[model samples]
Target: MTEFNDKQIDILQAAEKLFAEDGYDGTSIRTIAKEASVNIAMISYYFGSKEKLLEALIIHRTSGMKIQLENIFKEDLLPIEKVERLIDLYISRINKNKCMYQILHFELSTKKRIMDMNAFKDVKYENLQAFTKIIKEGQELGHFRKDVNITLIPPTIMGTLVHFQMNKPFFEPVLGIKTEEEYENYIKNELTAHIKQTIKALLVHEN
Candidate 1:
């Protein structure tokens, strides 16, 4: 695997930051060229276009996760460990750049026709497969309830963690949290712990 040259990395990083801050429609190749300190023709030469560059960023970020989750699901780990680690990686990935999450969330609802689902379909399906497969295996091993809807639970877990920030502010005042950083890490850790506890309760046989 060859390395990304300084110029290539700069364009990539600039694309992620600008695309996140400005949204897809508002971002342009010239702006990225300016932000990256590269000529517009150079970006076109390396990455084709701004749209392709954005797709590359999402793919790059999620690819590591796809590989990690695949490894975890293949191991002989316990059910609760599987669930906990899944949530852990998911949150840690988000924590790396919370702003990117906002960019992605917006893209899904507003730019679907242009962005289409294919840009991220694999990542979504890969995660759903990992969680549902784990749930099924756990059920067979008497860790999870056989009657539980594994598919529903997996997506529900995703929806909850992803949207927790959106709901955090409304509930934060009643709970009296301080700065945004405090609220973010608090939710990240709490969400992981809560998911662990919930899965623990779902276990039919405790070891």
Candidate 2:
């Protein structure tokens, strides 16, 4: 069995949990080391610094998700099926990295502190190209309406799926829902239905 030293595993797990709860500026290397039960200096020895560790965590999570999406969209599927699969992938990835997603999203929504170029230094081009390819295929196959702008669709679709995670607590207060499981079911039904109908309105033709 592949084994990680307790200190190493502890650092990673501690960083992930802390970063999830407290965003980049709010989390500290000392706090992480303390949480991990390791020397504060050991964080630098292991990961160089707080920022590098955060960067590595993002890269690790995104790369795994990128590979999965690339494989999922490889086959030329039907229009509705493709939409369903895309939402399914987003929902699945969000569930897998709920904490990391929260941290990354905080950075995204903030007006003043979005990620700088250095933050995404190791990002894969294939991740972006895959989404572009999917849209291009839909256009080529005449599944997506010719009038609909391909460039605009993907980002809108991403925003729609992200809404569940981004505005979660607000949803409970506004809609009077309880429990994460109930909230997830609400998102599944609501977002899937919204995506299906919105895509139909945008791209599908029915007489």
By lDDT, who's the top model here? Answer: 1
For model 2 the TM-score comes to: 0.77
What are the clash counts of all predictions, listed in order? 0, 0
lDDT of 2 by residue, 71-169 (tens): 767766775576667667766676677787677767666744534435354344555566556666677887766676655655566677677677877
- The predictions' CA RMSDs to the true structure, in order, are 3.2, 3.9
Q: Which runs in model 1 stand beyond 4 Å of their true positions?
A: 1-6, 74-76, 199-207
lDDT of 1 by residue, 1-207 (tens): 123567887887888888777777888899998999989999888778766776666666665566688878888899768877887777777767666667777876775547634746777677777777777788888777777766566555557666776677676787677788778767777767886677566655556
- Worst lDDT run of 10 residues, candidate 1, spans 111-120
lDDT of each: 0.73, 0.69
